[model samples]
Target: MKKLKKINFLAFALLVLTTLTSCKVGRFIVYNFADIKDYEKFPARKIETGPTKFHFSTTTKGKVPEELTVKDKKYPFEKYLADHKTVAFMIIQNDTIQYERYWQKYNEASIVPSFSMAKSITSILIGCAIDDKLIKSVNEPITNYIPELKKSGFDKVTIEHVLQMTSGIKFNEGYKNPFGDVATFYYGTNLRKAVSKMTLKVEPGKQFEYVSGNTQLLGMVLAKALKDKTVSSYLEEKIWKPLGMEFDASWSLDRKKDGMEKTFCCVNARARDFAKIGRLYLNKGKWEGKQIVSEDWVTQSTKIDTSNGSAWYYQYQWWLPTKTGDFMAKGILGQYIYVNPKKNLIIVRLGKSKDKVDWPELLANLGQTY
Candidate 1:
């Protein structure tokens, strides 16, 4: 009788857990269980590229330092990658591929989700829109582009405010909560509706809050400003095609066919190709002697803003390093594109989960050595 009762108790607990896992909040986890396990298969919208592919020069010089020291301690590079569940680790120096390695079947051709790194890409698109004169300036009221948001408490918001994540939009960025705004943005359909429902919690540009909704709002503004052109097309023509990315990347959409992209996250591309974005910024928005994005825009976008007071200084959509001048585009689950202009180096790291390695410190240490 005792043994039977114990078995029944165990079964009951599992049944309750399963039921909880199937709820709306839990649905994202259950539905994407397979995708979470296999990142390469994450669904996304195709961002097609043109025929010409940019070729990266290869060199054997400057191998990754066997180990990187952090906080006065040394850790092996290979161990760091393995421990962090790194899928791809790449280093580029002087416009040459210095070191490249792949793990768990991911290689030069494999595409991985960029998570929030797309935020930086979206900011670049905004700069392009400004350069094209589609929008007057970053200071222009975002409502000038998206009139629909005018009455949504976004009347005072500007393009610069959204890029700086100072839109003061009241949004819960918690990923763990199933019913939170972030989960709705990430797993729920209908991004347009999701963003439209957000209300302003404070005055725009008063305080810096890193909210994905800010980027989503910016996307809506871009869509309005571009009119007939899609964000993907603008990116393709202005940056991707010109940069010569080898593979056609994709952005995950809220729905199939015509749904809006989750502009705050989800740019799926190869590690090698993602490195080009860093190199583009490192070269001050010029690609192969052509001014792809204006030098002034790149300067403003990557320049660190100390006013935010965040541990990682916030710039236009990029994260400024603790050290000055060098910057990085970071995403959830250990995705990073670290650029050091002084060293003429770019490091791309993509992983399945948060890595144990402190990349900023590692980069700072590398900055000292290389």
Candidate 2:
């Protein structure tokens, strides 16, 4: 009887250890676990907007091609959507909704997570600050605005470097690693304190590296520069209201109500509303003939940076394809806002899968055939 009791105790201890380990892993991939059913329900802080809403004119003439070629393999677009676990797919052309579809009970009212696409929005906010003359220039050192970062090894880091993602901060962006900086930042309570712990490992602007820490630092700089306003208010006043976003969006904060936004990720809004952002860029920072973001800033923001080499394939917080006049704002788990100015096209895809899709090629095909 004593031997049986001892074996049971050992089994219970093993079970406890396994449970503890799983909890850690759960915290690490907290952002990765969302699916169509629960994606719209993720926790976030409200970024309230004004009453106006941008309405898109619809057309029945446009249709998506049934199939597309990826890596020389003929794949059906329907199958692709199913395989990728896509929740929403939308295409807008000439300022009209050509096609829009929702799956898994997701509809027009659903608030989808933008994930890293928030990086591009944060970049736009930086441009707005520059436009308002609140920020002198992108060339100015980040420490100029956030003086507390003076000793944080950002002596040579500029706002432009951070916007271009070449800040040289030693950060691990691997989403699979439970102990990495990204996981900690996503799950931690205090964003500023978490990012403040980062240290420099290389000279700023030496090479292009994609790290979430750069955007987080930019968020801090914007907060300090604005003084009286929060980033959310600035976004609402400058971009959201100006563009007439249909639904009020929310940006997830690190803490309940007072903490800073996780600017590297987590802007939640309807998929159709996201299309408006694409249209704003498509029109060269002009919405309804009004220059919302400066045309010069738009041109500069999307221009490719070849200082290091052609290998980086990055612009100011935007991803460029081999083709010119086209750019993309991407996020983890298959969120994309692909804009082709020449074609007057904007495609937005939101999904729960992490599978890699050739966005440029897909856009090229759609532009040619659809």
Candidate 3:
């Protein structure tokens, strides 16, 4: 009887292993959850820094608050951040580094995955594409580039529809589900094939439904528009090289060879370099008198507009946490690139997880103190 039981147990274990290995389940089982260091797990294309690096002027006597009140209880600012799984936090104002801190052994050189924050970066590229005339306009039907998706009822979908998150495309945004669309995009090796099979969940240009797939579709459209240039290469030429980034970053791809960038997420970069993205927008798309991206695009991206299926709080992939004209690029697990134009402030916080803090609110309040 004991021998028979052992044989049955072994059989079950083998069956489970086989099941996991044959699908995205195995990837999920191995990866488990997203982490800041997840850049190491995926294939990527490099974004090289420019010859000249722009540095934020730092102050010796930092003016950032040392104590923060959460839930009506006061706690040390560094302790609050450290206890809440924070890895890096930086505050920049007037092109100056006011306060910077790192915890959990993460430092200036550590590479952190951007997660959904890449969505905002993707939006920037879309704007750049328009400036380059590679893309005509946001009003153009996405089918102009991706004619294959026209059969999927994408003809009704405009580039602006996807940009505004009103595309109504069918996508499972939940990353934890192994069988979901996000998991397939994240773990599966073929993004273009998956994108080709995309379908609409509802009529386009009606309601806002934020999904990573919308950004991925934009990536596909951008790819089609570029013709010969990869999106990463365009980024290197347009933004990365011009921004004067301190470190060479990378955009994770779905595969190593003939790979499509996972443009919905996975821009792996350092904290200081990420803050430069905010600086670019803060200066209205100008870098040292050079208009990197159009000022009109910057205004359209950050302005509060609620017309034609646009969300009042979100425009072009940025989150307007309040009606204060501030916007941010947010990611899962507490990663943020917050820009406050009124205060000339930019705050970057990268972390292992959110840890239940009202981050947008905290950043807003912290900005008020400045």
Per-residue accuracy of model 3 over 135-226 as CA lDDT, tens digit each: 99999999999999988889999999999999989999887798899998888888988999999988887899889999999999999999
Candidate with maximal lDDT: 3
For model 1, the run of ten residues with the poorest summed lDDT: 33-42
Q: Score residue 173 of candidate 3 by CA lDDT.
A: 88
Name model 1 segments beyond 4 Å from true: 1-27, 32-43, 307-312
Tell how far residue 160 is off in model 2, in angstroms.
Answer: 0.6
Tens digits of per-residue lDDT for model 1, 1-370: 9999999999998997677543445556666522423333334566777788887789767576788676888889778677778889888888888889988888899878888889999989988888899889988998888777788867788888888888888999987777888888877767787877888988887888898998998898898899988887788788888898999988777766577777898888899889999999999989889988889999987776556432247789998776568888988777899988888989998888765667666765676576
| Model 3, runs deviating above 4 Å | 1-23
- For model 2, the local distance difference test gives 0.79
lDDT-sorted candidate list, best first: 3, 1, 2
Q: Local error of candidate 1 at 191, Å?
A: 0.9
Model 3 error, position 187 (Å): 1.0
- The alpha-carbon deviation from the true structure for residue 212 of candidate 1, after best TM-score superposition, in angstroms, is 0.7
Clashes of each: 2, 0, 0
